[model samples]
Target: MPDSHSLRIVHCFRAPVGGIFRHVRDLIDAQVAAGHKVGIICDASSGGDFEESMLGEMRGKLELGLERIAMQRQIGPGDAVAAIRTYKIIKKSRPDVLHGHGAKGGTYARLFGSLLRASGSRVARFYSPHGGSLHFDLATLQGRFIFCVERLMERMTDRIIFVSKFEQGVYARKVGEPRCGHALIYNGLANREFEPVTPGPDAADFLFIGEMRALKGPDIFIDALTRGSAMSGRALTAVMVGDGIDRNHLIEQAQAGQMSGNIRFLMPMKAREAFRLAKVVVIPSRAEALPYIVLEALAAGRPVIASQIGGIPEILGEASPALVKPEAESLSGGMVTAINDLEGFQQLLPGTQVLRQKFSVENMAMRLEAEYFAALGR
Candidate 1:
């Protein structure tokens, strides 16, 4: 029923939020523009009103249509029912490629895609970890179990896509060398995103945006802000954007630390809009797999101070002065330096031209499309 040149692609993921959601949206936009029929299958219970609004905007553009079903974050008895429901949806979509993002989605895509293959259907299965279970430590019992499952899943996957070399290395170390094909494709930004965003006159001294979780290091940001203020001998103003399970705890921590008056907490908003509220962006994440926020900040001509973990070093250059350990002491020092010498610190970041050339959405989509066809043997 479809043209020979066009492919039917279905994306599967659990939470339709954060980087995985952004990645899928970009891919669907490019695929639709290229005349491919695309659809999505993700958890219905995960995202909030903001995510609902985003999904509503994307509904009409999908030819195969969007399918949302209740999917759990943790492994449980309910997964069997969820998997059956998801498999039925995949069957109805009749996708040529079942591309999964994150751990849960990867399991469903590969498992269901292989099931479809067993039934005499030709479908390629692809998975992107997106720093999901890969963040687990090998020293932990849970990590061993997760890595064992990852090893078993390789047989069902046609290709494994890593967002960074750091992620790939982690996979190799944890799950052993992949038995299937794999590729490293960095996350990208659109041309419109490259335009600089000027800070407002009332912009705060620093900004922390992203999920307020321990893994993301919202507490670290608060601690650093407190210390930075003390070191400068003046109350440093800051804005913390985004909501998560740890948000209330972070707020309480700030209050207990006597920083309640200086920090403003707000709900999650667009990255560019949030960028204008601050003179400098701080990403003190304890772990990451090449965050899009870092790319977006640099594209908007904003100075950034980020933890030297995951693929951040790869993005900021190994020798970048902005790179710091994910510690309150180190980040506080970096924050002070940036606040004292804003102009010089801004110049230390990667230029817009360099970021544009390396992380373009067009290139990311083109390469991914090529890989899809290659996997299909076309």
Candidate 2:
């Protein structure tokens, strides 16, 4: 394994936005502190100047290197061209371990890692699904095709790292039990993230910070906001912070509900910065593989009302009051209750000591570092 602290690690992923990017950045920071050299290879086509500045900060911390290549989001002939370019970049980096963060990243990591082995290079290949392609169901043609690709990719991978047990279970049910090594590791919060955040004097009543996609249930949030306001008999303001393809649709939904004046849409920023603008964090996701918002909000001592799906229950607890069904009516009811009883809802949040015991970046990095060495047959 070339010693844990001295291993050369390379991470490949499609975009430098959202949770996957955050996960990789935290990992690289910890790896560097532990004396490991790490590099990143991700899509340059997606992020804007803000994301680029974040990546620029990443470059200062990474000891191995960084490569930003033009990559597409969906499958096409262009993927072959992108893979060849990514392979050349990875090969030149001479990494001891190649870790793929999402679907496209996993595909490139395994195929190219295997190809390198064929040419006498030694490198450990690991994939973390992060609810990418596995969200599709086998009842559909695309789902079956992706599942098949996953099954084939297993042969080349040394180990598959599932960020949540819910994700691991879903992959097993959809793609079948893994033929190679696998582990269930929960996503962790940084030490700084654990410090409580005090909302500004002009803080809103609620905050929604994530992609504007329907999968994240922003529509449900908008609908519930209107419904909650009606039920409470007063106007409640909220902020939606993020950008995605679904932004216009969500905006229309908010406007159609006649709550647009009460809702504010801001571009994405650091979660901590977003926290300062709202007293409570709302995670209305229809599905997740242990979202960082849940941990981050809880760590910052904010109450959360999240849908009871995926690894959310695992975080908020099966019987947690914050857990609600992923529907507008249910969400509305939850919202009304939260507004009517803010103090009670605040009391229901998971304790800081409990969160610290369950999700910490130190634990996550230490376990992953050991797993990387183990995958090398050390």
Alpha carbon lDDT at 125, candidate 2: 95
lDDT (Cα, tens digit) per residue for candidate 2, span 141-219: 9999999999999999999999888899999899999999999888888877888888999998899999889889899
Off by over 4 Å in 2: 1-5
Highest TM-score: which candidate? 1
lDDT of 1 by residue, 269-299 (tens): 8899999999999999999998999999999
Give lDDT: candidate 1, residue 307: 99
> Lowest summed-lDDT stretch of 10 residues in model 2?
1-10
TM-score of each: 0.98, 0.97
Clash count, one per candidate? 0, 0
Tell me the TM-score of model 2.
0.97
Please estimate how well model 2 matches the true structure, expressed as its whole-model Cα lDDT.
0.89
